[model samples]
Target: MKKAVLINDTTYDYHHGCEAVVSGIKSSLLVRGVEVIASCPVGVHYKKMNNIEKAIQQSDLIVVNGEGTIHHGREKAKWLLEVSAYAKKYNTPSVLINATYQDNPAEFDKLLNDFDLVYVRESESYDYLKQRGIEAGFAPDLTMLLSQTISLPEYQSRNGIGITDSPKVQEGMWNFQMAMKHGWTFLPVLRSYRAEGEKSATEVLRHLKHLFTNIGWINKENGVSEESYLRARNRFLCYTVSEYLKKVSGLQILLASRFHSLCFAIVTETPFLATSGNSYKVEGLLRDVGLSSRICELSDFDDIADYNAYSFSDEEKIKIKEYKKSSLIKINNMFDKLVGLTG
Candidate 1:
């Protein structure tokens, strides 16, 4: 069996960027009969550099789940360089899969310059690679690959109105209000689930006041054991808001600030207004899928309803499907290329 090592340098939230990429890698490698061993388990901090090195030594290939190399300062980038050097020392073939360089250009070039394969998640990363003379190619988020393994909610009954979160929440609500005027059930669903301590969701709700009708918050780091996860996974109303996702299935329209929340909507094929934080990673994913236009500016909050309606168009919806398809194809090709390298 082809043993692969996946390094997930992230806090094990319920759903995170690295976890998502790892999921994609797992699915792709499974198809090619490869076994993967992630160095850090979910919710476990990876402080042991020795363990990561050992995993790399035992594997036929190494995959650094894309979350860019460094951020804030150069601390994470430093760690990444250490790991990359270790991989090179052992001659372990490494693949940087689905990464977003949310870092300084100089730093990104330095960290990503030496790699067997670098699968970029956005055009910016690809262009950056070109400028720096690094071997890199653009690919979509692994969440798109979920299309094959997961069943999304069917668009069985799309209510005329769709409510979203962020400042653009008003736009979705206004549309829903219009639909409600015609006798429809119009409710705006907002979810908040960061590793933030208790009451984060409540705080957001309090801030939103009466704008949001449905609110859900989940802090996954609190309890994420095998049994706890299973229970949370199986619970009808896990974390208070999962019920909405479970009930709405495919028909719920989401306007979200969180990445995984948006990802949940994508896996469900539920149309949404992805409220981008101050991060290029989100925008990169949106651009890859041709849905960049669906994002709303924070400044648009005052007249969110108007802004959402003004900016969102039929063209954006058409691009969603196209981006999804292209993302999957790009990732599949990356996997095929990596598998060939190992063989």
Candidate 2:
């Protein structure tokens, strides 16, 4: 079996979205008979460089989960640079998977050039890597590929809605604020996984306490049992924010702040609208789907009813299905090409 090492510093403790992304990458690789070993930047602090070095020595390929570096921050940029340098040392078939586009330092650019295959989720991102002269291709998000496995329960009730910690909400309140405009009861599901002394959690909890009467906060501080995790998996509606689309399949509409939430919405065939978070990549992905109107910028929500004026007809439904099919075909083909699985 070809051995592969998955590198991502993301954990499920707080970022459930990343947790799902990692899970999707691993699950997909496993199905192809790839012996997969996973590691994160946090491991570097404890196991030291020797741990990743040893894995690199034994692996046939190195897959870097690039979502960790989309933001404009020193720490994220540094992490990308360090990981790239380490991966290059092995001369393995290194692939940067599901990364968003971001401006980085010269060293970061140099590190990107070292990849054997670079798969981005957006065409704009494909253009980005090509501009930098990195061998790149576009693939739908791995999360979108895995969402196909979701079997939604019959939504027997319309009691609640869900949203994630997106700073953009304060600006684009129409999607969440104007819920009554479309005759659906909006129940906001708010979750927090902040560690002790984190003010952001406290602030979000305070605001959400008023916005949502029903909360689904998963406290990793309490720790997650195997049973709880399984139960969470079964309850499609209570899926992590990205999985929200699957859970709310029966709802008339979904409005969200997170990227995966919109993705879930499409996968579940649920009518949904979203406000862009701090990430422009989410906006770019939405544009690729031809649902740019679905992305309400903080500035665009000045009139929540604007979206109400748009027609939601069978034509729109056809568009959603076509988009989903096209994206999945590309994603699956990429996997086949990567593994040389041609029949």
Candidate 3:
């Protein structure tokens, strides 16, 4: 069996949407009969370069899960560069899967050139890399592929809104308040990892301290000091990707700020109004699906009602279905070439 090492931004944290991306990549590799040997988070794995080198030496391929990691942020991008360098040194084939780029194009060109193949999750990143003279192909986010196999639970639609809260946007709180004032049964959804798999007692305590400290202000504002208001409102806390998708499928609409929250909305066909966060991933994705009008900036909260009233057209649904088919074919073709899989 051809051995592969799967590296991602965070693999063990189930709370983050990237966890689902990792799962999807691993599933795709396994379906191709590749033996996945090492799976580790980039932050923790980069500290032990010697171990990474050893793993690369033993593996036939180095598969990096580049889900939105190649942005202006120095940390994750630096880690990917180092990993690519190690793969090149070991003369092992490497491929970056389902990535997006928002940083220095020249730097990305140099880094991506080291990989044998590069697959981006959206056109913006694909064009960015191609314009920089790097050969990159476009593929949909891996989570969409995973969602294809998932069987969502049948639930009666309550016609209520679901709100995903992020610390990056203060206006998200106002949106939440508005939902409550309107008596909408808004489900609070958290797409961030909350350290649920920490093994050490000290680590657990540290995570709890961090979580409470961050959300304590919101609790105070709501006059609920005993527990976090966000925590109390969260309907999908600590849920696996499958469970989260099933839960999201029941919602009538979604108000999302996080990129993956928008992905879930798309996968479930749940109409959503998105607020821009730290990156253009959300806007780029909505534009790709012909739903650019669905994007609402943080300052545009006053127009929330207009956003809520928006619905997907039959033509848009048909477009999404066609996109999903073509995207999956691209991914499957990549895997077949890499692992020599016959289907």
Candidate 4:
């Protein structure tokens, strides 16, 4: 068996969207007869970890799950891309996938060439990589690969508009208020699966945060609008992946603020529109599908009726279905090339 080390195994986030990415990467490699001999989580710095070098040295492949981490040339990205340089020392092949390559330092660009393969999640990233002289494949975020395994449930009764959170906190609160003002559903898009009492310190901190945020005024950093904030946070606390998708698939339309929420919307074939997020991902993805008009701003919130009961257009439905289908096929091919399984 070809031993491989999966770096950036990001599944600590019990969020199903994140889980899908990790699962897609691992399963693709497994089917290729590659064994994940060891793995590393997202939080740790790989260079500082004493065992990382040994893991990389013993493996035939080093797979980096570059999910949203390669942009900005930050310390974390440097640590991740450095893996390619490290693997070269042992004559092992390294690959980076599901990445978003944006404005990064000119120096880090050289580090990219060492990868045997690089697959980006959006066109913008692919363009960026090509401009920098890296032969990178363009693929949608691996979360879409979930559509192949967890097929959309049979359509049944779907209810009113549902709103999800944002990378930006203020926008999240605004999302809650808008959902409440119209008596729509407030779907919390990202939540961990850990039981509440599992971590006492984390539990205590959450209680303190909730109590602190309940103090009336909408402090941009400290809090949001009145009771809606408290109520939404309480309701947002937990979900199994099954419950999360069931709720997402049942929504008539979802106004999303997070990138993964849009992925959830696509997989479930739920109607959705998205606002600006902390990164270019939302805009990049919508544009790729030729649905850039779906991008909305808070100023346009009241005018939401323009897209009421919005569903994908016949053309967009075709585009999205094809766009989504490519994710898995591309992922499988990336692995095939990695292990020389490409026929």
Number of the top lDDT candidate: 4
lDDT of 1: 0.56
lDDT to native, each model: 0.56, 0.58, 0.66, 0.74
Which tens-of-lDDT digit does each residue in 147-213 have in candidate 3?
5675544543536666665644344456555555554444444433433333467645644554444
- State the lDDT of candidate 4 residue by residue for 1-343, as single tens digits: 7888888877665455666677777777788888888878786777766677788888888999888888777888888888898888988988888888888998788888888888888888887778777788877888776687665646546877778866566777777767656667777655543322244576557545544544234343444554556454655543445567778888878888778888888877788888876557778888787778888886565457744458767887887787777766776676678788222
lDDT of 1 by residue, 41-131 (tens): 4323344756756777788887777554444335655555445556787888877776666545466566665577878777866775676
N/CA/C clash count, model 2: 3
Per-residue error for 136 in candidate 1, Å, reads 0.6
Superposed model 4: Cα runs more than 4 Å off = 194-234, 306-309, 341-343
Candidate 1 Cα errors over 4 Å, as ranges: 9-11, 16-20, 41-50, 68-73, 105-108, 150-153, 159-252, 299-314
If the candidates were sorted by their lDDT against the true structure, best first, what order would they fall in? 4, 3, 2, 1
Candidate 3 collision pairs: none
Tell me the lDDT of model 1 at 212: 39
The stretch of ten residues in a row with the least summed lDDT in candidate 3 is: 189-198
lDDT of 2 by residue, 238-294 (tens): 324443444556555566666665666677766666776555777777778777777
lDDT of 2: 0.58
lDDT of 1 at 58: 81
